[model samples]
Target chain A: MLLLITRTFKESIRSILRNGWLSVSTISILVMSLYIISVFFVFTSTANEMLKEIKNKANISVYFKADAEEGVILAAKTEVEKMNEVKSVEYISKEVALENFKRTNANEPVILESLKEIGGNPLLAALVVRANNPTDYQTIDENITKATFSEEVSRVNYNKNKELINKLNSVIETIQKIGISLGLLFAAISLLITFNAVRITIYTHKQEIEIMRLVGASNMFIRLPFIFEGIIYGIVSSVVSVLLLFISLKFIASYVSLTIPTVSLMNFYLANFGTILGYQILLGSFFGVIGGLMAMRKYLKV
Target chain B: MINEENIQEEKNKIMIKFDNVSKTYKGDFMALEEINLDIAEGEFISVVGQSGSGKSTLLKLIYAEEAATVGEVYFDGNPLSVVRKKNLSAHRREIGTVFQDFKLLPRKTVYENVAYALEVSGAPDEEIAENVPQILDIVGLTTKAKKYPHQLSGGEQQKVAIARALVHTPMIIVADEPTGNLDPIASLEIVRLLIRINELGTTVVLASHDKDIVDKANKRVLVLENGRIIADYPQGKYKIS
Candidate 1:
């Protein structure tokens, strides 16, 4: 058994070396496909991280009536915090809201003069509500609108920011869908290309395969060498793609950071190094073996 | 009704038997018909026929490469159709088959081509090391072992094929038009090698159309015309006339 396996391995290596161009072209296709998959991985992961950050910043502010008591507003804030969908609720007093407005627009002298012309702070005290999940924001909004303090609530900021929120949600969802479909499409195409390449390689060896059968080689014996050849292609292409991804990510890291400071491609790749490599190897091997098996099917009938 | 002992005795005497064997392709074309023959152990037999006369088909039957369409082929009293698919390789290993085209792996060296037969059977390293050189020497291609198929002459390549076939030390060697692609000198060399192998107690079956080689073989010959045996000669020539 050991002898058979060793001989098969040696034969596989010799075949790869013998058909130098075929082997090289197959490996190149595998690398390109795997690299695309890895890039998609990095792209989707970065998009997911960005989406999480955006969700964290997204919150609904509920302003109280001008004449509403502070005690009632505080109680409402506590009530909103108790909802399952709500993460936390922060109370912003009218005075603090005005101060924040003034400080943020400090560069505008006319705004300052207009603010001074007003007799008193006209801002409403409000409770800013955060949700655990972006999808839960709608539920939290509904709950707040139907709360006991609904009469005391002047208006919910959710209605005002509804368009922006809906647009953001759809954009993120569209990206996720496109990413998944593109990944699948590329995977299918890569498998087909690899299958054809392997089929051609085996086609050239059709006579040799017949000779092997005539010499009394079992089906498994004939299959093992081709399978090993496929596996070698997978391994080599995976290593090349991972190295390509690593080096390219490293090269583009600083430049990407300058444009989108929030995204550090190198850090993302390094952090998921094992996952990236594992995916490439697993996918590459799957494609290689399946391709080889499908190609060898008709010829092995002899 | 034969007893077990008698059956075993019969198996020990006959190497191959065709019991009313017939082969037809695509239901209409009759390649062989109602042929009954037996080859004993250690015998050298040549099958001679014109093109499409079922010479190659007869060789294919012995190796179980093609099934007799309407009859049974027995190797040592074991019907080939009854042998399970998994055991087909084991049966085939007992018979070495050489083709007209040499059928050598072009990318492999002569040594690798010969050793591949033993390697596929999972022979140990020491056995391969011991047997491959001896077989190459027998085929008279020891120095050319490192050469590729394309690097050698047609005769040398056929010799490599024979070496590969012999490496397993099979009980029978089937050469189907083995000299078809070689010149007369090279063809004579292959015929001599087959004769030497038959003398070593391996049953030799040669299927050929070359009149000179077939006449020179002087072995038991089965002549076929239109898929039926027309003549069976002990020490036969290529043509009766």
Candidate 2:
């Protein structure tokens, strides 16, 4: 068995080296596709990270009516924090709200003067409620508005930003959908091209395969060399593509930072290098092996 | 009455048998028709015919490359039809095949080409090491073992193929127009080599259209025409009109 394996391995290596240009072209296609896939992975993950940050900022501010007691507002905060959908709730006293207004309008002298004219902390104490997910905000809002202390509440501010947040959520979903579709489309095209490349290689070796069959080589013995070729193509292409992807990320990272400063593509790829390498190898092998098997099926009849 | 034990004894003596074998291809074209023949162990037979006369088809049947469409082909006391597809390789290893195209792997050296047969059979390193050089020496190709197919003459390449065929020490050697690509002198040399191998106790089935080679073979000859055997002569001289 060891001898068979050794001989099969040697035979496959000879075939790959013998068909020099064919091997190059096939590996080149694999490398290009894997690079595209890795690039897509980096960009999509960056986009998702940005969207998550945006979603984290989506929260509802619930203001208590003037003359509402501080104890009541604190109670409301504690109650909101206990809700299943609410991640956290912060209690802002009337004095803090007044201070915040003053600090925010400091750039506008006119607004600061108006705030001084009204004086004596006319602002309402509030509970800022954050939900676990963007979609959970609506439920949290409805529960708070219908609570027993509904009479003490001035208003729930979630309805004002509902449209904007919903729109953002939909946009995130749309980008995800399109990213997945395009990724699959690209993968399919790559597989088809690789399949044809392997088919061409097999066509060139058609006579040799026929001779192998004629000489009483077992079907496994004959088929194994092509399988090994596929695996070799996969491993080699994946390594090359990883290197190319790294170079590309390094080349484009600074420019991408200029336009979209939040994302560092190179850092993102390097941070997940092992995972990305694993994925590239898996995809390359999928393309190489499945393509080779499908292409050589007709010729392996003997 | 022919008893079962007596029939088994008879089958063991014959290396190959065709019982009412008929082969038809697509479009209802008959390639071999109602063929009945038996070849004993260590016999050398020449199957001579023009193109499309079922000579190749007959050789194909012997090697189990193609099955008899309407009858049975027995190789060494076992029906080829009963051989499972997975076991076909094992069956073929017992019968080495040589093609007119030589079918030598272009990238492989003459030594590698011969050793490939043993390699495919998963022969041990010691056995391959021992047998390949011995077979090359027998084929007079020991000096040219390092040369690739393109570097060798037509005769030398065929000799390598024969060396490959002999590496298995197979019971039967099936050559289909093996000298088709060779010059007259090369063809004669190939015939002479096949004869020498036959003398070493291997059954040889040579399919050829060349009259001079067939006449020189001077062995049992079966002349085929349009998928039927037109003449069968013991010690035939290729006397086809």
Candidate 3:
């Protein structure tokens, strides 16, 4: 049995190689599809990261009365932090607030002049609150309102950030949904194109297939090389696509880093590679092999 | 009725015994009808008939190319109709075939073509190495091993086909007009090659229309007319008329 199986395997490999450029062309198609899927996922991940950064920048600060005691402000901060929706809260005393204002506006003449005109430190002690999810800022604002020491609070300032944060959340959500839907759609299309290509190759060899059946080739013997061919296409195409993607992204990231000085494409690529590698293999090789086997199905029938 | 054990004993060792098999093509045409034949081990039998006489049909029955429309064609007392798909390769592997048209794989080298049967069945590399060349030598195909079918002469291609048949050391060789593509000399060469293979203890079944060749074969001949066997004789000479 071992002897027979091995011989069949060797013959199948030979038959697959017989198609020459036809097999290569099919593999090329698989590579293109896999590359498209990989790049799309990369773009999706990058967009996700950008949206997260936007959410991080949308924190709301609540000011307390100047005369409010430290215990009251600390209690308010703890109460706001304990809310189910609120991510975190930190109390800033008047002195710390004033120092922060000076540090931030040191290069701004208008802010400095306004501060001097107010004579003493005009800024109030505040508690800065951030939500776990950007969309939940409204719940945080409401929780802060019903706090035990709401009477000590001079003003709650989450109202201004609420609309902007919600808008950002919706936009990011739309992007996520669109990316996933389009990614799956195109991956499915790619799988089909690759499958069609392999099927055409098999159809051309239909007579030879019948002959193989007549001569007593087991299904595995007939199927093995074609399967190998598909896997080979997937692995080869993925490597090509991945190398192209990485090189192109690295070049673009360098330019973006120089110009924007804020958007770090290199950092994003490095941070999310575990996900990218998995997606690439899933899209390229997994899809490629399935396409190949599906294409070979009709021909493989004895 | 007195020998229930004898029936089991008979079942164990019959090489090929077709009780009654008739194949009819579409419409009212009958390709074969009511054929009863028994071929034992190591028999060099040639099926001689004109076109449409069902000689090819008989070969097809043994190869299971087409199922018998009525009655049974048994190989070693096993039903051909109900052979499982997984067992198909095993069943076909046991019987090597040479086609009238010399159905050598056009793209494969002669060596690869000969070794194809083994390859599909996953024969080990060392065994393939040992057997393919030996079979090629047997068919006088060693020199043309690397050439593709299209590159070789008709005789050489047919030789490759014969070599492919012999590679498995099958119980029988069914040659369906294997000389149809060759000239007189090439045709003679193929027939002689079949004889040589038969001498090596492989059962040979040759189907042919050439009067001169069948008359000279001097082996068992089963003559057919209109899908029915008209004659069967040991050491038979061709008498198509």
Candidate 4:
């Protein structure tokens, strides 16, 4: 059994080497398809990360009266945190809020001057509430307004950003829908292309397959070498594609980080290196092997 | 009534038996008709016929490549039709077949081509290493072991085919117009090689329309004319022409 396997592998290597250009072309097609898939994964993952960040930033801050006590604001924070729709509520003291305002306007000399002229902190305490679902912000806002101590709350900013938040939610939904559709489309296209390439490669060896069967080779014995050949193609193409993906990701990461500084495409790829490699190998081998088997089905009848 | 003992006795002498076997192709074309023949062990039989005269069809039956439309073919008392589909390879492994096309794997070297037969039979590497070289030497292809089929002459290619067929030491070697693509000298070489193999206790079935080669074989000849056996001559020359 060991000898048979070793010989079959050796024969597969020899066949690949013998049909040099054909093997190269087939491997090239595999690499292209694998690369496209890898790139799609990267794109979708980055897009998902960006959408998550946007959703997290879409929280509503409730400003309280200037004289509202810290105890009242903290109680409000706890109450909002207990809401099923609310993810979390943060209590911002007047001092902390003033400090944040200063930092945010530090780049403008006029705003810094106005802040210094104002002397004491005039900013109101606030409760920042984030919801699990973007649409849940309205319910949280209405609940806060109807609370027994609603008079202590000077204003809720949910109404101010409602249109913007709704638009952001729609944008995220569209991106997710498009990502899924494109991913599926790319997958189908890549599979068809890879399968066609494999069929053509197997067609060239149809006569050799017939000759093998004629020599009294068992079906497994004849099929093993071709299967091994496909696996070799998968292994080689995957390695090549990984290398290409690494080089290309470096360029894409730098360009993308300029627009969305938090997203490092290369970092994402490295962090998921094992997973990406696993997927590439799985897809490459699946396509290579299944394609070869389907093409050889008609010829193996001999 | 024929008893089991009598059938066993006949099987001990005859390697292959055709009992009124007739093969019909699609569209009602009869390729062979009511053929009754028995080939004893170690017999060198040359089947001679014109084009479309059922020479190839007769050879195809022995290899179980085709089933008879009527009657039966028995290899060692086991009917070919009775062999399960999965056991067909096991049956073929016992009989070596050579085609006129050579059917040599184009990418494989002469050594690999011959070794492939042993490889497919699941022979150990050590046995393949020992047997393949010996067979190549017998076929006078020892020095050309590294050459591919296209790199060799027609005779050398056929010799490679024979080497492959003989590598497994099968009981029978069936050559269907093996010399059809070779010149007279090459054709004669193949005939002599088959004769030598038969002398070593292997049955050989050579099918050809080449009168000179068939006459020179001077073995038991079965002549067919339009799917019917016209003559069966012991130690006969080609008499159809």
In angstroms, the error of model 4 at A228 is: 3.0
B241 Cα displacement, candidate 4 (Å): 10
Decreasing lDDT order of the candidates: 1, 2, 4, 3
- The reply for model 3, stretches above 4 Å from the true place, is A1-28, A105-121, A146-148, A159-164, A177-181, A204-211, A254-261, B1-13, B24-30, B82-84, B107-109, B141-152
True lDDT of residue B19, candidate 1: 94
lDDT of 4 by residue, A31-60 (tens): 877887777777767766766776788788
**True interface contacts reproduced, per candidate:** 0.69, 0.76, 0.79, 0.60
lDDT of 3: 0.78
| Stretches of model 1 off by over 4 angstroms after superposition | A63-78, A81-84, A90-126, A132-146, A151-165, A247-260, B1-12, B82-84, B106-109, B143-157, B181-189, B211-216, B234-241
lDDT of 2 by residue, A159-236 (tens): 455666667567667766776776677677766766776677677778877777777788878888777788788888
lDDT against the true structure, per candidate, is 0.86, 0.85, 0.78, 0.84
- DockQ per model, Cα: 0.58, 0.61, 0.58, 0.55
**Best candidate according to DockQ:** 2
Higher-ranked by lDDT: 1 or 3: 1
Model 2: residues with Cα > 4 Å off, grouped in runs: A65-67, A78-85, A92-125, A136-139, A142-146, A154-171, A255-264, B1-12, B183-185
* Model 1 per-residue lDDT at A184: 81
DockQ of 3: 0.58
Q: In model 2, which residue pairs have backbone atoms overlapping below 3 Å?
A: none
